[model samples]
Target: MAGALLSTPNRVSLERLVQVAKERGYTAQGEMFSVADMAKLAQETLGCQAELLCGGLGGPNRDGVLQHLITGHPLLIPYDEDFNHEPCQKKGHKAHWAVSAGVLIGVQNVPSPGYIEDSELPGLFHPVPGAPHQPPSFPEESSPGAIFLLSKQGKSWHYQLWDYSQVRDSNLQLTDFSPARAADGRVYVVPAGGVKAGLCGQALLLSPQEGSHQLGLGHLPQLNPAH
Candidate 1:
């Protein structure tokens, strides 16, 4: 319960999740939470939409810029499958706001580090052709190319998001539980059981800076005995 505990509800218009994030070092980007009640996310976190859960105030003006990023599914927003960036008004696409970002994968029920946005990074990785295994790394010196954070739904990224909003508010409840936090210290895994049931919680690896670690599936030793 010490790590990513359940988010407490804001029965009195006070989001304990937001408070905890701010105290720990993270800020929410959505309109629902204010700057005073925010953590790491200076603007909007990643500009990506979590499956059924939506983030960043969407409107005719907002979506017009980067509408393609809003794929309804959070993971799809990274979108390595569609490498051609012609830049158009796609239904799911949302404008990639120019802000330094980092990949933040949250394992549903394990201990891990907290995600903080930064200008540097592990580098931008886009899937490549002919070598789907070797992902292309785009250097982001001044700004992080992508902010890959993990979440279950509209309010599922931070542990507090669920404890405070979902379960507490009861506004958005996911019938499926998922996003299993892996033991590798990275790569949040939403096991089928988690998707069907619900996540226990996430672990918090203490770190001073953002983009501190990268996610690994932790099941490759068996898959690739060569190692």
Candidate 2:
């Protein structure tokens, strides 16, 4: 996948995608991708068939949806009406891309917040865990969790996710901070057990130490099992 991304054509397309994002009021640091934008990145930019898999509305599949992203699946989560201040709430939904840079992180098109809102914005969407404060503009609701996964089956491509219970069913546990390091010295975590033997869990790693873009395939870190 990394090789394909660096290929001249795909690299050019990725640059174009970034340019389009910049034109849409997004910043060079991070950007939001609507369902349509995600589709474009998958099909037109990445050249893969993309699907928007939702875990339904709120809570239930939260862990599963998160696991998908943690394991290298690409996803885009849209904020729901649950985000908003009184009276004028529920007016709109905003979304951001879920990037798996060894570890899963959410990238926003808007700026970071100054204070924490009692809402779900900082809790669920921010790249790093913990509340920095309420976002300047993104007050999102508890998301149902939406993600995109790509796989090549036979002659074409397919997008899929864990069957919601596979993580627990497989007895897979997440090691938030794995000790193994990537070629770039970045660390990531991988599941020790899987629903089936020999399953390759996505190596969830730490975010970049410094940088604006953290979702690139520049470093495909080696996976280190928790066990």
TM-score each candidate. Answer: 0.17, 0.27
- State, as a TM-score between 0 and 1, how close model 1 is to the true structure: 0.17
Candidate 2 colliding pairs, count: 9
Best by TM-score: 2
Which of the numbered candidates is closest to the native, going by highest lDDT?
2
**Which residues of candidate 1, in runs, are more than 4 Å off?**
1-15, 20-133, 136-151, 155-227
Model 2 C-alpha lDDT per residue in residues 168-195, reported as the tens digit of each score? 2221221122122224363222223311
Measured by TM-score, how close is model 2 to the native structure?
0.27
lDDT of 1: 0.22
RMSD of each: 20.8, 18.3
The C-alpha lDDT values of all candidates are 0.22, 0.31
Assess the local accuracy of residue 133 in candidate 2 as a C-alpha lDDT between 0 and 100.
Answer: 39
Minimum summed lDDT over a 10-residue window in model 2 is located at 80-89
